[model samples]
Target: MDILSDLWLGAQTAFSVWNLLYCLLGVFLGTAIGVLPGLGPTATIAMLLPVTFGLPPETALIMLAGIFYGAQYGGSTTAILVNLPGESSSVVTALDGYQMARNGQAGTALATAAIGSFAAGTVATVLIAFFAPALSAVALTFGPHEYFSLMVLGLVASIVLASGSLLHAVGMVLFGLILGLIGTDINSGEMRFTFGRFELADGISFVIVAMGVFGLGEILSNLENEQGRSVTLSKVTGLMPTRADLKRMVAPVTRGTLIGSVLGILPGGGAMLASFAAYALEKKSSKTPERFGKGAIEGVAAPEAANNAGAQTSFIPMLTLGIPSNPVMALMIGALIMQGIQPGPSVIEEQPVLFWGLIVSMWVGNLMLLVLNLPLIGLWVKMISIPYGFLFPAIVAFCAIGVYSLNNATFDIWLMAGFGFAGYLLRKLDCEPAPLLLGFVLGPMLEEHLRRSMLVSRGDATTFFTRPISAILLLLAVLLIVSILAPAVRQKREEAFTDED
Candidate 1:
């Protein structure tokens, strides 16, 4: 079959010595940075994008792909160990993972995360190979109305990730949307809220906000609470899960991979949304729902699996439709364009080696990550056991360095420090950063699609309902919000994200 031939060609290209070495290097760097607070694949790839210009397109992409999935693997490590999610998608992982760490089950949580990620990555790779073109077609069918409706669904779903007051969550999402408006307007060619500072011209960097909130913010919270610091330094007991833990994780992993693979095909809905939705679903379905925000292994397993699977399958839109599914895939698209390669359906036939080899490399990278991470589980858990006095300084330093690297400006570093203080205040207010970050990330895209839909429809607001897919998505979002208002559902929703008083 032509597919078999394509696979064989991809294997030959991906397994070459140089490609394999680059793949290993990419994943290694990805894991190292991913273990650090607030440095994610998007920033790392953006920084290295210049260096890759000199390399072959295939080799460069293969390496970048490795970094992406590798970071997904490593993000779970920090989420489990320190209650800091190095990657945005790992936010929910910290809910249960950090509790597990405090309860002396860090090793088990980390192991479960790793195993679930590997399984998901492996499955997503095959799905990409078999269904990329078909999925791309489905994605292309989504017009601006559909996209706006989809993002509406995403924003409403963001509330599910919050355990605090639903009102606070809505407020944070609105706040994030406002922050996202600080940059120049796309259509009017006018600045919204730059405040006469050119630094605000591009608005705030996500790196600055996330690192400050999750990385620096977390550091401040811990320093102020001496008891939390001691609990964070708990001993690492079992390095592996009991048989029951393994059995319980199986269903969640399977469900997460399925959810992730489907969601990943949506251009604006990649790993972050996939992980959030997966965790929401898992908690909703669990028999002992109260265990979720505590130390539930299912929480760790499902989100990890969803994130990795989403990370892999996100390429479907980028590779086949010339649309980026996330920031990393956008960077991947830039790399392809720089190499004089145009993305879209033609690329598969015209640049078979690049397309298929990149696909093959994903599976290769997953294998490398599994091999790289499994043995170091013990070492990773132990590193956090260092005295908080010594540990926090290093985290703050890394956060500053990572934020500065984003645009090579000292201003972002200061911005991050400011947000750090704000994060601590929010912690005191009992709010989670996840919903705010989610809103910030999705806000611009949502607005863009909404405006486009209106423009295309000649200012007709009925377009969203007139379109079937858009209508269905909006209905679902509405239904979800209505259901959350019910007494029984509202109580459960609150329980899912927040601890009971």
Candidate 2:
């Protein structure tokens, strides 16, 4: 009963004409960015973040959250129509979705992806509304020691979750951690890795690294690939799924929603991991696994569902725990901190309207995505015909502009370009960038908590293992390392793991 009243209060706050307009604007812009290849939510949000400075904090957060999830809905449109995934999480959609497109079932693929995403997003939003308070309570008990250990567990989970060689994933994480350590030390005011450069004092900008790796790197990769014209079918076909397709999708959607909603709460579990894990789970559960890559509807349905669910639920940790599970959430954290709102248990107690209004707005934004996307599929498909030369240069421009906007520094622009070249080389070498991004985001927070715990314990590192929660978390991290290194476990892991799908 109390929950209902609070939700009503939230709706009242979110229902204002101005707030509604911003919600629509956010979803509209999000869908646009999602349709265009290489402009992901992170890049789009980073670029627009400065503009939100004038809005009230609640309104800004509501709009930003809408854009974040709306990208998940729009990313699949590009994947199915052009075999170009706008977001990493949409990569699996390319496998079966493009196959369906090649076979002239593009309309069906697009429709199903949209519907599945809507369904998953709706369910996850409802779950978040009810579960967030309870989850925040669990998070409130965590001290610096516990938070530090949780981050360690998160890093381990990320390494395990990353597709590719375990050693390579660890190496990427370590590199990210090292990169994160480049700025002035928090405890001691001395710079560690500045190397006599004044610009290095502020550390590597997250926007620069994200834009360079995701936005610029994607542009370069797309430019390298020869353009292929859309293969149209001779006859028009139905867009709606058949009875058999619906039956298969039902189970996958249900399982995916459940899996994604749960995993998305954990640090490092976002849309990309949700999609990957969903594909793996679906494969494991399928009676005929051979159908997975060859126009399998379940392949399209599951990951789309999972990624959307994960996208919605990924807000949980950021909003409730003040811990960002991914780069996108990290940016959200920065936004909230800028607003002078400390995101954690007290956020809800102090600002219930903001909290619940954001949840209610998610449902509204998702409905908008479904209605807006279905009729616009043809338009989005037409966008794929735009020439790469015309398209990629714009992306490059945005990357440069966004990086420079961080500090309005041309040096940062040069730094971004340097990283772009480095990212291009790394991509060529088959090394992944996502884990590195994760490590970079987590490393500073991990260090902060570690130092705080040590100070409380008078410089005893053993304090990490002395606290119960921290002890358990550290043990789990150690166990994960040992399991990955065990010869027999290594063989099984190698067989089970596949490259980014």
Candidate 3:
């Protein structure tokens, strides 16, 4: 009854004409950008963030949420049709999907991916509606000590992410922390890293950082490594799967949904992790494992299901615990802050409309993708043929315009350009910008909690160890660090990420 009431409340907000239209536009643009290779959700969302500034918080968030999962749906289209994954999460989908295409089963693979993704998204939506509230209730009790420990655990856990090079990830996080420290000190009211510029008093805006690093940085990187796309199937006919194909999809979809839901809740876990893990699981569990990369329908179905489920469920931490599971969620935290809404346990109680509305809109957006994507596959395939040279100028112009609109200041634009160049250099060095973004987003919160905990304990450092929940969280962080350092475990982690594709 409570959930039913909550859903009703959410539906009211999500189903408004303007809200529905925003959601549609988001999914449509998300699919279009996703269909084009090399544009991931983080960059797409970052690029489009300025467009959402005029809308209400709930509507803006609903639209952004649509773009995220819509990208997941659209990615499979590229993988199956062009043998080029549109998003990183769709990389595994390309393995069997492309093989199926070559064997004249392109339509069948696309159908399987769509259906599995719909099933997984449907289930994951309900799971979030049910699970997020409980998680938030638990988080409501977290004190400064517990919160500080949790942030430490998050930073440590992120170091072990499938992102390349543990040392590079750690260094990026520290770099982000240093950047986050540039602002004035909240407690002491002293300038920390202003460097004699009055403009630096408020520190760098997260918006500028995100736009430069993900938006401009992505475009720069893509231009650097741009390649021609070879389409395997320009014309697809059969959009329906056979009954046997449906049967094969069922079990894998179910298992993937479950795996994705669980992993989606973990620190640093997102759609990317769930898809890779799901593909690996199906491979390891298959009776004829050799068929995985050779047009196996289950290979297409399982990861498709998992990525959608993971993409949906990854909202749990951001909505409830105020911790981001991925870079996109980190940006969502910034979005909430810009909306004057803090992302934490109190969000549910203070802004039920924003919370429940977002959850409900995901299902609506998923349904829209399922209905619209299959019929538009041809259009998406055609989009891949368009040269990147045509799109680059638009992206660059938009980045400059968006940053300027933030505060109507040209300085932010210049700052974004600098970060874009820096991000490009870092990528060349094999350093992932994800951990750095996470660190930038969480650093201030971590410092605030640490200072609060210290203040509460009269500057006693042992207070974190004395609190039961805090101690357990810190211990888990320690174990994670220790495990990553062990040579055997480290090797295994590397192997897991070393996919054949």
Candidate 4:
């Protein structure tokens, strides 16, 4: 009853004319960006973050949240139409979605994806409304030791789950941590890694780093293969799914929503992981696994549902615990900071309107996406044919403008360029940048919590172990690391025996 009342208040706030307009604008822009290949939600949000600076905190947050989940709705469009995944989470969608298009069921695939996304988004929103407050109440009891241990677990999970060699992920995390150390020491009031540059005293802008790595680096990568690429927009037929199609999709959609909702709440887990896991689960559980990559509607339905559900639920950790599950959530944290709102357990209680309104807005945004995607499918298909030559330059321009707009500092622009080059090089080396971004975001908080915990315990390292919560978190971190490495060791041993044979 209390929850319903709060949600009613939230619905009232979210339905206001200004909030509704911003929400509509956000989803519209998000769908546009998601239709284009290689321009993901992270880059789009980072670049457009400045646009939210002037708005009220609630409105800004509402708009940003809309964009985050709206991308999930739009990403499946490209995956089905041109076989290009606009978002990483849509990669699994492309496998079967593109096949569906090739089989002349493009409209059915798109319709299924949109409907599944809406269903999952609605369920996830309700879950957040119910669970976030409970999570916040639990998090309110955490001390510095527990927080530090939680961060350690989060970072470890990020590295372990990142798609690449374990060693490379570790190296990237270390590199990001080093980069994070550039600013002045918060406790000692002394410069640590600034190297005498006064600009360094304030620390490197996270916006710059995000835009460089995700925005510019992606542009550079796309340009490399731009010449050889061609898009064939499949004609969408049968906009409505048949009764049998709906029956086949219902079970997978339900399973995917459940899988995504659970995973999205975990540290360092988000849409990408959820989508991949959902597809794998669907394939494994299907009576005919061989049909998975051959225009299977279940494959299209499951991952699309999982992706949208995860995208919405991933906000749970960031909102309730101030822990970003992925880079997009990290950017949301950055947005919160920009609005002078400290993201943590207190956010829900302290600013009930903002928190609840944001939650309600998510449901509204999902509804808008369902209404908007179908009519705009043709426009999105045409967008897929735009040449890279025109697209990359515009992206570069937006990134530069967005970074420079942060503090109006030319140095930040240069710094972004340097990081852009670094990001490109890192990509060329097959190292994933996602873990690096997580490390960079978590580094300072981890350091602050570690120092505070040590001070409380007078430098006794055992304090972390003595605290029940901290100890459990640390144990989980250790288990996660071992889980990742043990398989590699066994594989290496097997390879050695095969070589000998």
Better of 1 and 4 by TM-score: 4
- 225-341, model 4: which lDDT tens digit per residue? 563334676356689999999999899999999999988877667888899999999999999999989999999999999989999999999999888898889889888988899
Estimate every model's Cα lDDT from 0 to 1.
Answer: 0.79, 0.80, 0.89, 0.87
Q: For model 1, name the residue pairs that clash.
A: 163-497, 163-498
lDDT against true structure, model 1: 0.79
Determine which window of 10 residues in candidate 1 has minimal summed lDDT. Answer: 226-235
Query: Best candidate, lDDT-wise?
Result: 3
Per-candidate TM-scores read: 0.67, 0.87, 0.98, 0.95
Q: Clash pairs of candidate 4?
A: none
lDDT for 252 (candidate 3):
98
**lDDT, residue 110, candidate 3:** 91
> Which of the two, 2 or 4, has more lDDT?
4
Candidate 2: tens digits of C-alpha lDDT, residues 363-394: 88888888887776666666656666887777
Error of 1 at 307 (Å): 7.2
Per-model tally of clashing residue pairs: 2, 0, 0, 0
Candidate 2 clashes between residue pairs 3 or more apart in a chain or in different chains: none
lDDT score at residue 239, model 3, on the 0-100 scale = 82
Model 4 TM-score, 2 decimals: 0.95
After aligning candidate 1 to the native by TM-score, how far in Å is the CA of 201 from where it should be? 2.5
Residues 352-465 of candidate 3: C-alpha lDDT, one tens digit per residue: 999999988888998898899889887898899889999989989988998899888888999999999998998888788999998999999999999998889999999999
